[model samples]
Target: MKLPHPIQYQGSKRNLASQILQYFPLDIETLIEPFAGSAAISVAAAYNNYANKFIINDLNKPLLNLLELIIEHPNKISNNYEKIWNKQHINSVEHYFEIREKFNKSKDSSLFLYLMARCAKGAVRYNKSGEFNQSPDKRRKGTIPERMKKNIMGVSSLLKGKVKFKSEDYRLLINDISEKDLLYMDPPYQGVCSNRDSRYYSGIDHSEFVVFLEELNNKNISYIISYDGRLGDKKYGEPMPKHLNLEHIEINAGRSSQATLLGKKDITYESLYLSKALQKRIINDNQNTLIMKELKYA
Candidate 1:
């Protein structure tokens, strides 16, 4: 079963979820995403036979609230979304700004979701004052209501009883993870993108995150982290802690949408840092076909 991501999230691994899941251990009783932007990995994992319980936690309240609405009241969200989507917004940009203003003032979950669906490049942006600032995509017509409804229903069904959504900082979620759980963390990148995109959501404190990883490492917890990788010739992202020994697998992510937006013509690559424990398990299971050590990032 294929499930489309309900929203387009910057630095999302929605396209690469299958490939990323291949690196996870087959016996995960619980799957958790601490920085669950789009919760793409968890959503994708829900369809897989491996994990039964899923935890999706993020500090972004508005996004998490929208996700919760979908999980609990798919029909409600669908109905509200259709009202906004099916109507004619004569000037799409002006209509988008109008919705943005309402969303900023009201913090309405339904309106926020609508904005996400219609925003430029499906990218969510905000100004320093914490207002939605992304412009409308001028090139293509937004997804039709029929398709949107189908996706909403499908994703909601996929996530129904198995998934739990939490609005919390990544650090607090860390304590909830157990040895039987597989943690998939797609934290914000450390460099330029983090600084530029921090306005959209809270930025990660790299130093604190590294310290947390060390704590997890000391406990021998298994995880797969999507952090700093490469974009064409120029590399962007952060590396693992200096003292941590982990296996790094680079996934070929095709062209970067962000790069395309910036008018650059370079292939993008993503790095998946697996805890040593998980790496050993994958190797033992003979599922390490794309190990970065043997193959170049294509």
Candidate 2:
């Protein structure tokens, strides 16, 4: 099924969502995303009925607000987006910069959506002063208003009453997690765009993230993390510690766009880490499946 993704975000797991979600248990009360970039996984889960409820949280307040508007007031956002998008046809480059400046000052959700739609490579980069600074994609205009409306409304219909939005630190959000909740994390890549990763408001400390994972394990929480991977021979970020007792799975994320542009063939493999608790649940579920097959054959 084609999932509705109104916002085009860099490092979104939209393409890899189905592969990641195959590991999800049959029943999930809530799916919590602490670093919900575009909320790709949550949207996919909702469309596929993998989770009954979702908590989409991000430290980026403007992005979170944009998502809220997309889900709550699709028509309002779509209409505002059409006005902004239509004006860009007269002078795409200049119009984009004007929208970006206004968004930086007002932090308006509608302006944020237009910026995200037209930004280069769908990458979100912020200045040190916390302003949207990514340049617009010059090759073409963003998604058409008609298609954008379709995506926005499609997403709203699926997630209208099923999602809760949060704009807080992940640590604070994780403190209230219960066993029934399945947390899916897609934190910013550690070494991407310099050591500090200007793409995010702040980069996560590698050591500190490891400690956070340890705490989740200690609590016996079920979780899945999409962290660190290899691009051909080069690897990005440090692998999860073995002491965490997590199961590591490599997902083929297809070719590297950068490599392809450079006339090289490099396949990207993203790392997917499953908590021991979730792994055990999968095993039991698999065992039951085999038993059911045996009973049917008998």
Candidate 3:
């Protein structure tokens, strides 16, 4: 079974995780994710027994804390989550805002997860002042508490003793990578989503991130990057430097949900960049030949 997370994330790799995992080295000692939003890839890796150990890190402190709570105390968090989720309130929107206010003040993980689940389209957005500003989803009743409880338990079980979660910058996490480690990075879409979505990551330095990629290249680290590929006629994401020697592969993600919500149907394709170390490891064979070709020129 696939590992499922309780909260919804904007750029989650849930659908494309299997495809992405195929590009990674099968006999990896450690699997590390620096910008793990919902850690969908890590969850998939753990569930499928892809690595000996998993390291999931994110810059989002509250979200990381919430994930930790689910790992350590799934039952307790689920009980509290059900209580807030099943409340027969006067107005759902007003009640959502009330919970949001409480979460902001107390930084409660359970309330934060509930807010994310009940938020509009599960779109994680923050204001210039670093406040959770997304509105409530009026069309749906959100995910059921029991269903989320099961997902939480599943993730916790798969990750037990084999996973480590941290709230840290991507650079710091990348610096800790060893030769036997495989890294998967899913950073923010700078120019792409900022036009439509609020800046989810506060004060992120894109140029510095490029420098980290250079460091990884110099060290010959095995890694894969999921970056913005295309939206209609426009290309998105930071343009990679040729010096990095990273192979590109595009994954068709069907229609953009955010664009659809805004009354437009635009096809979205995410670009996956495989580092030179991973590229050299992709051997020529009947089964792997097709995947290798897709990575060479895309």
**Candidate No. with top TM-score:** 2
Model 2 Cα lDDT, one tens digit per residue, 25-107: 87688999999979999999999999869999988888899999999999999999999999998889999999999998999
lDDT of 3 at 243: 77
Q: Which stretches of candidate 2 lie over 4 Å from their true place?
A: 192-195
lDDT of 1 by residue, 4-87 (tens): 666767667888998998887877878998888888888788877668888988888888888888777889988998888766
Model 3, position 184, has a per-residue lDDT of: 93
Residue-by-residue lDDT tens digits, candidate 3, 115-180: 889888788777766778888898775789889899889887877677788887777876679877
Best by lDDT: 2
What's the residue-level lDDT of 137 in candidate 1?
A: 83
User: Which lDDT value does model 2 have at 295?
Assistant: 100
Task: Compute each candidate's TM-score over C-alphas.
Answer: 0.88, 0.95, 0.88
The TM-score of candidate 2 is 0.95
Error of 3 at 1 (Å): 3.3
Candidate 1 TM-score, true structure as reference: 0.88
> What TM-score does candidate 3 reach?
0.88
Question: Could you tell me which residue pairs clash in candidate 1?
Answer: 228-237, 228-238
The 0-to-1 C-alpha lDDT of every candidate, in the order given, reads 0.80, 0.90, 0.80
How are the candidates ranked when ordered by TM-score, highest leading?
A: 2, 1, 3
Where is the poorest 10-residue window by lDDT in model 2?
189-198
